[model samples]
Target: MNIQLKHGADRLLFGMKESDVKALYGEPDRKYKDEDKNVIYLYNDKKVRLTFYQDEEFRLGYIITANNACKVFDEKVIGEEWSAIMPKLEAKGIRAFEKENFDSVDNYFNEANWVIFQVEFGEVIRIELGATINARDEFDWKF
Candidate 1:
């Protein structure tokens, strides 16, 4: 079992109970049933399969997958707004820069081929999410 905590909070990462998730993030984006009609909640671009079986320690076992996969982008965007929240940037971790105004970063974003930004309490890295492709299939940052 892999356990991940955010900001020292024992927040739910993945592979958690259905009830526990409901208590935390509330209703999911969508709900569905299997061939047997077992209700399950789909959250954060993840599909949590809840199975009600007999002769088992737990009636339900969930298969978790992020529901909006785009949440990574969302998190990065939010982290940008609150750059002060992060301490520094590192490998696989997010950090925030010292600049109070994001205009400079914004300018860099539009002017440069890649946008360099920090992830709060995580890491600092560049991204090219919206990069366009050229005639030769090469990425062009002109936009």
Candidate 2:
């Protein structure tokens, strides 16, 4: 699928309702609710996790995936070396920066497109997307 990095899972986007997510991905492998009542949906088979905030009208708040076969804008992201993906990201005008005290890097086209790539031994092991108020605050402070 021609998944855009700006969106969440292939067809999922930020702010989508929980029912919509369920319709698209089926039942989650597991579900959790935090003190704040935010729901976390884990789809182990798909290697993806989604978090929705009840305070935010049950809108999607986060998407994280470790699936190596996942594609972003038709480009294979997982399992690819940073060197191979850097140019593609840059070509899309996405700027990347290494996070302090972390082994991962963050890439963004904008707030809605913010993504984190966790690296270990020079390979991207995980990818995270979506917006959290706290993250936006920190991002604003940094930029």
Best TM-score among the predictions, by candidate number:
2
What digit string (tens of lDDT, one per residue) describes model 2 on residues 1-143?
33455445677777788798889889999999978899999999889889887877778877888887877768887878867877787798776555533434533223445677666656666788865344446321111
Can you give the lDDT of residue 128 in candidate 2? Answer: 82
How many backbone collisions does model 1 have? 16
Q: What are the lDDT scores of the predictions, listed in order?
A: 0.34, 0.70
Query: For candidate 1, lDDT tens digit of each residue in 1-143?
Result: 11121200124432344566578767778767666555555554333233322222223332332222213322433224334323322233543223333533431122221223333344233222222235696433221
| Worst 10-residue lDDT window, candidate 2 | 134-143
Superposed Cα deviation of residue 69, candidate 1 (Å): 8.5
Q: After superposition, how far is residue 77 of candidate 2 from its true place, in Å?
A: 1.1
Distance (Å) between predicted and true CA of 35, model 2? Answer: 4.6
The superposed Cα distance between candidate 2 and the true structure at residue 60, in angstroms, equals: 1.0
- Distance from true position, residue 99, model 2, in Å? 2.6
Model 1 residue 93 lDDT score:
51
Best of the candidates, lDDT: 2
